[model samples]
Target: MTGATYDALVIGSGPNGLVAANLLADAGWSVLVLEAQPDAGGAVRSSHELADGFVHDTFSAFYPFARASPVMLGLDLERHGLTWSHPPAVQGHPFPDGSWALLHRDRGITADLAERAHPGDGEAWLRLCADWDAIGPALIDALLTPFPPVRGGLGVLTRLRHVGGVDFVRTLLSPALTMLDGRLGGEALRTLVAGNAGHADIPLDAAGSGMLGLLLTMMGQTVGFPAPQGGAGELSTAMVRRLESLGGEVRCDAEVVAVETHRGRATGVRLRSGERYAARRAVVADVGVEALYRHLLDPSDVPARVVRGLDRFEMDPATVKVDWALDGPIPWASAPEHAPGTLHLAASRAEMAGATAQVASGYVPAHPFMLAGQMTTADPTRSPAGTEAVWAYTHVPQQTRGDAAASGPGGTGGTVGGDWGPDDRERFADRMQARFEELAPGFGSLVRARRVLGPRELEQRNANLVGGAVGAGTSQLHQMLLFRPVPGQWGRAETGVAGLYLGSAAAHPGGGVHGAPGSNAARAALAHARVSALTALPRSVGRSVRGTLGRGTAGGGAS
Candidate 1:
């Protein structure tokens, strides 16, 4: 492997890396993807280690973004043996009163449910869905494309006026709860939106929260939050298989320790085992922003602006995820007509916001707002018959200050240690379980086994999940779009090094299983190669002219 060379060397085997590799391979480039982990997928991997028969996604599960992404869709992964499965309902939020707020793929059904929950809300839901239908594709295209999305922007601009133009923009800029309040009447509908917004580390009252909330819920309504039919790993496996079929290669257990650069340009990468592989065209990195800049590349290779920007770079909050293998289906006190694959554990918009605020303020929320998944409900292949595989995750501060859930749940006090040690993780898991038990009376009895992955454990599994900051970096407005990874880069894949590109979640559009970053990076590399090829003739001609003149001068001197 040390003497090997390829047209492109992708420095991770996550979705983004694989996407980039596949695209390059399609372009007839010799692509090689090097993965540090024993397995290929980064956060996209799954395992059955938690229990005997239940399959669990180690990191990310549902992929509404992937379904809606042009890059993923264009891959035709279904042909490569990847299939998606969705629950009867896309998502659901249960209330203390036994009523539920559910988002179904069918707009009419979702609207009817909303209307039943609150008068006029049904109409409002339809209007919202209709508006999204008008602008959503262009909006998504604009988002997934590189900065200054000319074509996608034009598409969005053409449709903006019909969607209330500036007014719609203002609505997106407003806080999520505020937007929901103005648009819909019922708490149930608002709760559904707010809960989706809470998926990010953004505060419910923040400006960007509305856009995220709307984007996710609208995506659910359109595509549904679908997962791989067998497991999340299957998504990655299909990508790898597709890439391999395209004459690409993926090397596992190949940790890239340093990016080899020459004269301010990336030339290749060096592994931890002292092996080096060269990249003839470009080296695409699918690692974290900080890890790439601060660790992989040398200081001289990185731009001063990017290095200085790192000082202000903030990561999203750490997370604690709990996975459970259940003996039977989750015993909801009042199940919905259509079972939902995803569930939100929050009482209301206010409760969700308060919990988010608590985490932001360096304290664990007593009643944490959690996003949970019922894997078996979505795909029965995840577990044995009559059983379920479930997981829930919530945010925690990078550093612990105190526990705010003193008397909240699981009979634990507010003084659980903040270090996330064994004791701390157990206590927090108990708290999360208690939250689940609140909505489902017999939840504990159904749990056959459980696994708690704290920040450290998560980071250990995937270095890109720095401190368990799943989104790679904060999705806040301060660090998004032009400001993501750094301000000078203009949200492009180029890392300011001549032949290196950032294809990770840290790039523009932040996180999610979408392959935009990878596609963008691969396209950028291809564009650069085309430009280089186009200019080669002139450069060679000039060199020939110079050589002829030099030879003439030497001949005259000899005479």
Candidate 2:
């Protein structure tokens, strides 16, 4: 009820938070975003920490999910200073046998490459691409839409009716490892398929996970792996700028410690600084599910069922990312195309599986699958000319069992401890670097400077990446789609509390900078606001009528 009041108070000025704020403000509502970090964008930030003039994307780099995202593309980010850089080839997976599987942006060229590898593999690629065309649009719609996905789901069903219902459902939920195993003859092609899906914490054999890679790969094929011209942070800058232009304000370093509520509804928020802001319409939380329910709100206000479900809400695999200000482009045995686009260092399907299994067992994998990006190749502005700013990240154990067997490959037979200290960081980072060295000799010498961030460091940078689980939470079978974040609040942004919404990666459509969680949260808040108004209309009218009648009765008595 003061100057500080806003129509909506969004906690955490991440991409999702800004999306909600921008949408709310664009709809003629006052919105304010509170960020814990000094800057916005959450995980999608870039910095020159590696070395001066060498801009390294601190967290996420590739934008397959973001680029093809309906929410992102529809937002007109280009007009807000977000420029995309695409490499000649979208992605390449090279093997030790002087061969690689290159996914070209051009379908014909990709098909030709596939045909050269295996007889019918080329046709399989075409058929897969065609299958994508059939349901891809509908699938994207279904993914971005709020849960239940009536229209988008039905659209996909209609498109795939000829594919047969049983097989259709099977394909939708099939594991990527299973889908591409025998169909794509060569290990190179198979690795490409499964490796793409492995981008998430979900294992290769996990059902409902095969769809992840298929979706990303198809999206990459259509639109190359585009990143911001300057760095990943530029995308965030554009979104924040767009939000500000819409009259919404983002306050960085505003740590939201609690969600102030009255009568079972979110009333406002209290920052750690002890500052408070009233929410006239809603309080949308772009924080994690655990953080929102366990810490942000009072225990009594949170639903008991939600608290219990939070316990079961599996955290995704932990990631260890290393960025280096390299002297020059990576010298790969496979030559130029090896380091182009977003590259996966894992060689075979078996290799990917073993690494994921190690992660599953809470063991630091000796041979972890790594995803490295050649920033200079995509956008030269990321570093000085002739030099490459490269980054590689791989999943590690969230907690070690303290068993000696958990030590990374070829190690003594015991746990090295779970904490990510300087030793742990350097040791694992060396293993990852050595992996690159195997694929591209002399990879270690190219580094002029490097920054290594394990789970703890990543969590310290962004709390939303709890335990360094980057995909927000596990992309597991029981946690996908409607079951994501939580079972009840799937597909929508509103949380258990009325007038409160979860807008972070922990919400429906889970993880990635695609903006589905934020957009959907905004839409949900708007929908709830409309419903509240409609429901209160008759009550408000009745109250007015009674007041008038009471006044009339009082006047008559006076007379």
- Tell me the spans in candidate 2 whose CA falls farther than 4 Å from its real position: 1-3, 162-165, 336-339, 402-416, 538-559
Tens digits of per-residue lDDT, candidate 2, 261-374, equal 999999999988788899988999999989999999999999876877888988888889999999988888777442467888776788898888887887777677889888
List residue ranges in candidate 1 displaced over 4 A.
Answer: 407-410, 539-559
RMSD of 2: 6.8
lDDT of 1 by residue, 1-559 (tens): 5759999999999899999999999999999999999999999999989888789999999999999998899999999999999999999998888888999999999989988878898898899888899999988998998886767888888998998999998988888888877888788878888888999988999898989999999999999999998899999999999999999999999999999999888999999999999999999999999899999999788899999999989999999999999999999898888899999988888889999998999998788899999999999999999999999999999887888876445455445667998988988998899888888899999889999999999999999999988999999999988898799888888889998999999998789888988988888898777556655768788577556555322110111
Evaluated at residue 87, the lDDT of candidate 1 is 94
State the displacement of the C-alpha of residue 397, model 1, in Å, after optimal TM-score superposition.
0.4
Candidate 1 residue pairs in backbone clash: 366-405
Give the RMSD in angstroms, all C-alphas superposed, for model 1.
6.5
Question: Model 1 residue 58 lDDT?
Answer: 95
